[model samples]
Target: MSTHVDDADRLARVTLSRTIEPGDLRVTGLVSELGAGKVLGYLEAAGEVENHWGFALAQELGRVDPAQVLVQAAEQGIRFIVPGDPEWPTQLGALSNTGALHDRGGEPVGLWVRGAHDLHQFAGNAVAVVGSRAATSYGTEQASELSRDLATMGHTVISGLAYGVDQAAHRGALLAGGPTIAVLPGGVDRPYPAAHAQLLDAIAERGLVVSEAPPGVGPTRTRFLARNRIVAGLAEGTVVVEGAVRSGAINTAHWTTNLHRPLMGVPGPVSSAASAGVNQLIRLGQASMVTTAQDVITDVMTHAARAATGAEQLDESFVPDPVRYPQSAGPGPAAGISASRR
Candidate 1:
C-alpha cells in the first residue's frame, strides 16, 4: 500500500528526525512549506551551511543512512510517521505556532511510533494526567482513580512514561480497560527507567508507545522538557494530579494554558509541600480545581462549548488569528486507530 513517493518522504523524515534537534519549529515549518524530500535536497545541495538548521542538520545528514534507519526501525516494529500519513496526528500542527519554549517548540517533523494503536485517532480523544515522579500515596491514588474514571468514559489517558504519577495514571486507565498512551522522551523501542520495562510493555500491548526521537537514542534533560508539549498537545485538556510549584506536571499545565486548552488541578493538603504548585495554579486562576472525573468532564466540555460559541460557529478548519495558526489540530480526540493498520 506504500507508494514510492510515500516511501521517499518517510525516509527523508526519518533521516531528519535524527539530524534535526527535537522541537525546532523554524525547520519544522520549513518542512511543512517544502516537502521532506525537497528539504533534504536543500540540505544535501548546500556544500557549506551557515544557518543553524542547515548547519546542524547538514552535519548529521552525512552520517544518516535514511534507508538503513527506516529498515532498522521497521525491524524493531517501529514505524516512521510523516505528515499526511493516515496515522499522523495533525493536532501536532498546532505546535508550529506555539512559539518556542526553552528554545524548544514546533510540531515534530515526524514521529517514531511503536505499538498497534493509531496515533492520529487515539490522540484526538486523549486527556493528559501528569504529576511528580516522587508521588505520595494519596497523589498516586488520586491519579489512578481519576484516570480510571476517565477511561471508563472511553477517554484515553495520556502521560509521560515516568515513575510516580505518570505510571499510576497509565495503570488506572488500563485497569478500566480504557485506552492509554505512553509518550516517551527516548526511543520507543527502548524503555527509559529500565525498571518500567514491564509496565511499558503492558502499555504497548493495549495502547501506544510514542516518541519524537529516533530508535537507539537515549533521553536527556532537554528531551524530557520537549516531551511535555506532546503530552499536552495530544490531549483536549490536561489534568495535573499533583505538582510541586516547579514540577514537570506544572510545566505541562503551562503548555495546556498556552494551547488555550482547559487546565485542571487537584488540590492536596495546603500544608503539604507537594501541593504548592498546583495550589498556586488554582489560586492564580491558571487552572480550575478538579476533584473528580465529572469535574474534569464539566470543565473540558464547558470550555469546548464556549470556545465553539465564541468562534462564530467555527470548527477546526477556522482558527482565530490570535491562536497564530490556521491549521486544524484535527477534530478533538476520537477513537483509537490501530498503529499497525490504517
Candidate 2:
C-alpha cells in the first residue's frame, strides 16, 4: 500500500488536529467519510456539524495555521503524519472498529511523531506494557523485566510514557537494545512530565515518540484517556503490570479487551493497592494471569494481530463499567473546544 497523502490534505489535518483533541469518534466518522480537507472546508465555510463539539470549534479555525505549525514542528525535529502517510501505523485502523469507552473512540486524524523509527513498522507488531503513573516498586520491576525479555525476543514495546511502569517498560526495552514506542497525551515537542525530558530525548534517539495532539498543546485527563487507546491500538496485546482501581492503565486494559487483543495482568501482593485493579481484572476474567515474560510472550504471540481485525471477537454491546474519564466533560482542549474540528 502506498503511504503518500496529498500535502493539502496533510496540512488540513494539521489544522484539524490543532483545533480538535484526539479520538473524537463523531469527528473521526466525518473525517473517514469526507476527508480532512473537505471537513476543514465545511468547518471553515460554516458550522454544519450537528449537535457536536466540532460546531463549537468551528470558530477556532482562524487561529490554526498549518504552514506555520509545520515549520515550528520541523524546527523541533517533529513530523506531522496524516492517515495515508508513509509513517502512519496501519494498526491504528483497528481503532475505527472499536466501540466507545468513556465516550472517546476512533482513529486519530493525525499523529505528531518524533525520533528515528517509523511508527508504521514498530506499532503493528508491538506489545503494550502499561500501569499506574504511581506504580509500586514491584510493579515497575515486573513491567521492566517483562519488557526487557520481550525486547530481547524481538518484540517492540509500546507505552503511554507516563510515570512508574510506563517509564520502567521503556527503559527495559532500551536496555535490551530494542526499539520502543512512547505514545503521549501532549505534543511531541513537550514531554508531559518535564523531568522525563532527558529520558524522552533518549527514547527519541533510539525509538519513537508519538502523539495525536499537535505541537504546542498540553496534556489533559481526556487526552490521557485518548492516548491510552492508541497505546492499546498500536500493540497486538497489552500487559497491566499494576494499576489502581481507577488508574489509566485499567482504562488501557479496557481498551485492549474491547479491541480483542490479549490482556495479561502481573500479579502483585494481595495487599498492594497498586495491584488492586490488576487483581480485579484477573479475578473478573477480563485478563489472564501472567507472571513471567515468557508467559506474556506466549499469550501475546498466540493472539497477536487480532486487535487490528477482530470485530467478530469483540462484543458490540460491551460497555466498560467504573468509567475513569469524566462523563460530564468532553475530551476537548478547553471548556468549549470539544475536539471539535476533526
Candidate 3:
C-alpha cells in the first residue's frame, strides 16, 4: 500500500512542480526554509519583487491552481511522490550536496511517476546505460548486450528513451525479461520524440516512466539537460556506450562523477567517431573502462560494500584506481569533430 501525504503538502508540491523548474536552488532554499505550503502562500501574496526569479514565481502562481493540476494528474493515472513518501527514491537526496552543479542540482520537490513498481525498489540496484542518439552499430550492439547481461544478473536497467543506444539498451532488458526504467524530459503522460511512444509504453508496463514535470508539460532543451541528473542520481553507476564530447550521455556521466558514483565508459573502435566522448572520459581519468556486465557489477558492488562498511572513508587505498587510456595507440586529434555545433 502507498503511504499517505497531507492534503496541503501534496497540493503544495504539485503546485511547485508546475510552477518552478527542476533544480532551482533559490526556490529549493525557500521551500526548505519555509516548507512548500508556506512558500506557495508567500508566492500567492507577493505583489512584485525586483529580482527576476521572485517576479517569475509570482507570475507563475497567478496562473496555476494546485487542485486542478492534481485532478488532471489523477485522471491520467499519474501519482506525485514527494520527498518523504514511501515510494520516493532517497538516493536522489545526494543532489542537495552538489554545490556548483546548481543548474542541475537540488533535490526535486516531487516526482510524477506512472507505473506499478515501487520507485525506491526499482532504483535500488539500477545501472544507467546511455549514449549517442546517432550510435553506430557497434555501440548499439554493445549497449544491448551489456544491458541484457546486467538484467540477467538481477540489475534493473535505466535509460532515457532516445533513439540508438538508449532504445537498444531498453530493448535488451526487455528481451532478457528484466525490468527497465525510462526517465523522461517531458511529462510522464506525454512521450517525447513521438516515435518512441510504443517503447515508452512497454517500459512503463514492466517498470516505470518518471518525470519531474507535471502532466501537461513538454520537453525543452534545458529540461532535457536537467533530466540527466536524475538519470545519474537514481542509478548505482552510469555507463556511456558512445557519444561525442558534448552529448547528453556525457552530461549524464559528469553528473554521475560529481556525485562520486561509479562512472564507466565502453570503448568503441578507435576509428569510430561515435566513441569519442567515452574515449575522452577514460583518457582523462573521468571514468573507468568497462567492457562486460561483470565489470560493471564488480565496480558497483565494490563501491556499495565500501560505502556500507565505511571503508571508503577509512582507507582510500582499498578503492580501485581510475582506469587509464591505453598507451599503445598513437595520439592524434581526439576522434570526432567538435561537439559545439551539436
Q: Choose the strongest candidate by TM-score.
A: 3
lDDT for each of the candidates?
A: 0.81, 0.81, 0.82
The parts of candidate 1 lying over 4 Å away from their true place are: 1-5, 45-47, 50-53, 311-342
Clashing pairs in 3: none
Q: Give TM-scores for every candidate, taking all chains together and pairing residue i with residue i.
A: 0.87, 0.86, 0.88
Q: List model 1 lDDT by residue over 78-169, tens digit each.
A: 88887777787777888777776777877888888888878877887788999989899988998998888788766789999899999999
Instruction: Output the better candidate (1/3) by lDDT.
Output: 3
- For TM-score, candidate 2 versus 3, the one ahead is 3
Residue 115's lDDT in candidate 2? 87
Candidate 3 structure quality by residue, lDDT tens digits, 93-198:
8877765353656778889999889989989879999999999998899899889877876789999999999999999999999899999998998887799999
Over the full model, what C-alpha lDDT does candidate 2 score relative to the true structure? 0.81
What are the candidates' C-alpha RMSDs?
A: 7.7, 11.9, 7.8
Error of 1 at 77 (Å): 1.3
Model number with the top lDDT: 3
